[model samples]
Target: MKCPNCQSENADTAKFCKKCGTALSKKSINHEEMINSMGNTKSGDNTTKIIIIALAIIAVVLAGAFAYMFMSGDSGANDSTSNTAPAAKNTTKVNDNQEKTASSEKTAQPTKTSMSILGGSFSTGSADADKTYAQIYVGKENAGTDVIVQIYYSRDGNSLNNGNMVPATVHNDGYLYITSADAYLYYPDHATINLYDSSSNLMDTQSVSLSPRSGTQTF
Candidate 1:
C-alpha cells in the first residue's frame, strides 16, 4: 500500500501514512464492519461455549442420577438376597406356632362323660362314714304326684343287667318306691345283697340314677 499524504510505501495492513500520519484511503475493510464482525464472532463463540458447558453440566447430572438409582436398586436387591435365611426361619416359626395351635384345638374337643344317667336325680345319705344311707325323698320328687314310675340306670336303657328299667311298688298315695326296706330294698352299686323275688329276679338291683352328697364325684 502507499501513504498518499507523504508518498511513502507501507504494508498492506497500514491504515495511516507512516510519514505524515494521515489516513491513506478508505480502510481495506470498514472499521465498523470489522468491529461488528468481531462482535458476531465473539457472540457465536460465546454461544458455542455456553452450549458445551450446559451439555457438560447436564451430562454430569444425568450420570449422577443414574448412579444413585442404580446403587439404590442394587442395595435393595442385595439386602433382600442376604435376608433369605431369616425370612425362611420366620416362616418356619409361624408354621410351628400354627402346629401348636392345632394341637391345642385337638385337646379342646369335648371331654369324656362321668354321669351314668343323663338327667336322673338320686340319693342323699347319712354323714357317718360307716352308716352312709343313700336316699332321695320321693314324696318331694315331681311335687309328690301319685303316678306310675320307672327308673333307668347306666348308659343303655334296654339291657337287662348293666342298664335296666324295672317295676316299683306304688303306694296308695302314688309314691313310687324303687327300693323299700319293707320290700327288702337294695341298690345297684352294692353287690353283697343277694336278695331276689320269689320269681328269682334280682331284687338287690338299684333302680334310679343316684347323686351322692358331699365330695366331688366332681368331674
Candidate 2:
C-alpha cells in the first residue's frame, strides 16, 4: 500500500507514513469528494465568464448610445447654423435694396418751377454816371424746340441800341440767351421788346417802363 501523506511505499496493513510520520488513513483523499470540488470550480469559472460577457455587452451599448447622442447634437448644431446663414444674407440684401430705392427716389425728384426771370435796370458808376441803363430778361417754359428766337429791343422808338438789334441765341434745350450787349445800354424809359422767329413771325411782345424791377417777366 502507498502512504497518503507522503506517497511512500508501505506495508498494506500500516496506519502511518514512515517518512513524514503522518497517519495514513486520516490523510487519505476520497475520489468522490475531489470530483465534487472540481465540478464546483468549473461552475464558478462559467459564472465569472458569463458576468464578464454581460459587462462587456453593457459597455458597448452605452458607448454606442453616447456616440449617437454626440453625433446627433453636432448634426443639429450644424443644421441650425447653415439654415440661418442664407436668411441673414437675404435680410441684408433686402435692406440694401430698400436703401437704394429710397436713394433713387430722392435723386429723381423733379424741379418745382419751369422757369424764372431775374434782371432789372441799374446805373453804371462810370463816365456816364448820371445815365441809367435798362436790362431785361424773359424766362418761360421750354418745350425743347428747334427754332431760333430774336429779341427786338427798341429804345427811344428805334430797334437799335448802339446801332445794333438784340438777338437771342437759342440753345439745344430751347433756352434763349440775349447776346446783344447794347440791349443793356439804353436809358431808363418806356421800351418795347418783340420776340420773333426765324421766319420773321412775331411770337411775344412786351412793353415795359424801365426801372429797377420793371422787366422781371415770366411766362
Candidate 3:
C-alpha cells in the first residue's frame, strides 16, 4: 500500500505511512471499519453483560422471596402449635375433672341395705344369779311399713319354740320378749333365735347369751 497524501510507501495492512506520517489509501478505510466493528462488539458485550447481571439480580430476588415464604410458613405452623397446646391441655384437664367428679359422686352414694334385728338378754330375779329374761329389740331398721316379724327360740339344738308376730312392729321400734319365769329355766343358758319377715323371708339368725344375775352386770 502507498500513502496518497505524502506519496510514501507503506505496508498493505498499515493505516499510516511510516516515512511521512501520511494515511494509506485502503488501510484508512479498513481501520475505520475495524474501529466501528470493535465499538459495536464492545457495545454488544456490554449489553450481554447487563442482561446476565439482570438475570442474576432477578434470581437473587426470587430466592429471597422463596426463603421468606418458607420461614413464614414455619413460623405460622409453630404459632398454631403453640396456640393449640393450651386448648388441648385445658380439655384434658376438664375431662380429668369430670371423671373425678363422677367418681366422687359414685363414692358419695350410699350402699343398699335390708332389714336387720338385734338381741340381748338379762336376769329377772333381784338377788339370784340366774339368767332369766331375754329381749330382741328393733330400732329404725330399713323395712316396709308395719313390717311383721316372727321369732323362733331354740334352747337346745333339738327343739325350736315359735313365738307370735312381734306386736305389728313399725319400722321405727319394737321388741320380742322371752322369760324363764314363764318357762322355769335357770342360769348360764344360751338360746338362738331365727327371725322371719311377713313374706316368710328369713331375715337373721342370732344367738343370745344370758349371764347370771349380778349387781354390777351391764345389760
Candidate 4:
C-alpha cells in the first residue's frame, strides 16, 4: 500500500506509514470506496439518459402515425363527398330528361277532326232521261259549307270526259248531294268521284259502276 500523507510505500499489513508515522489503512479504503461510488453514479446516469432518449423516439413515432391516420380518414371523407356530388347531379339530370321526354310526348299527340264522306251514287236523271247524274252524300260535319265534286269517268279502260268543280246542294234528307245532268253522255263502266271541302282540300274519293242501274251504291 502507499500512504496518502507522505507518498511512501508500505507493506500490505501495515496500519501506519513508516516515514510519516501516519495512518494508511483508513485513507486507502476511503479513496477506493469514493471511486466505486462515482463509477456507479456515472453508470446510472448513462442508463437513465438512454431510457429517456428511447421514450422520446417512441413518442415521436406514435405522434406521426396518429397524424397520418387522421389525415387518411379526412381524405377518405372528402373523396366520398366528392363522389356523392356527381351522383346527385346525375340523378337530377335524369329526372330533368324524363320530364322533358314526357313533355315532348304530350306535345306530339295528334289532333282529332270531324270531317268525312258517307256515301254516293251514280244514276240517270229523272228530269232528263238521256243525261246521267251523280249524287254524293256527305257527313253532318260539312253542314253550312260549300262542297265541290269532280267525276273521272272511264269506259272499257278508256278515259272519257271528266266533270270538275260541280257544286253540291243540301237536300231534305239533311245531307249534301252533287248532281250534274251533263256529266257524261254515255254511261261509264267505272267512275271515281272526288269530294272537296270549302278550302278546296280533297276530302274523300269513291269508285262507282254505272253498268247496272239496279245496283244501289252505299258507303
Show how many residue pairs clash in every candidate, following the order shown: 2, 0, 0, 0
Better of 1 and 4 by TM-score: 4
Error of 4 at 163 (Å): 16
**Tens digit of per-residue lDDT, candidate 2, span 1-219:** 566656677665677778887776745654555778899999999999999999999999999999999999999999999999999999999999999999999999574222323333333333322333334343334334323333344456655445234444444444555444542444434445555554555566555544323333332
User: Compared with the true structure, what per-residue lDDT tens digits does model 4 show for residues 1-219?
Assistant: 777887688887889999999977744854555788999999999999999999999999999999999999999999999999999999999999999999999989563222455776666533322455556666554456566777777777776665667776445453765555454445567778777766667877777765633234453
Residue 126: error of model 4 in Å?
Answer: 12
Model 3 gets an lDDT of: 0.59
TM-score, one value per model? 0.36, 0.44, 0.46, 0.50
Q: Which candidate order results from sorting by TM-score in descending order?
A: 4, 3, 2, 1
lDDT of 3 by residue, 1-219 (tens): 556666566788787789888756662544455678999999999999999999999999999999999999999999999999999999999999999999999889573234556544454555443434555565544433344444433443433334555534443444555444233342333455556565656667666654444322223
Clashing pairs in 4: none
Where is the poorest 10-residue window by lDDT in model 4?
A: 124-133
Q: Against the unseen true structure, what C-alpha lDDT does each candidate score?
A: 0.46, 0.55, 0.59, 0.70
**For every candidate, C-alpha RMSD to the true structure in Å:** 14.7, 11.3, 9.7, 8.2
Give the distance in Å from residue 172's predicted Cα in candidate 2 to where it truly belongs.
11
Candidate 3 has its poorest 10 consecutive residues by lDDT at 210-219
lDDT agreement of model 4 with the native? 0.70
The window of 10 residues in a row where model 1 has the poorest summed lDDT is: 112-121
TM-score of decoy 4 = 0.50
* Residue-wise C-alpha lDDT for candidate 1, range 80-114, written one tens digit per residue: 88899799999999999999999999989563221
1 or 3, greater by lDDT: 3
Judged by TM-score, which candidate is best?
Answer: 4
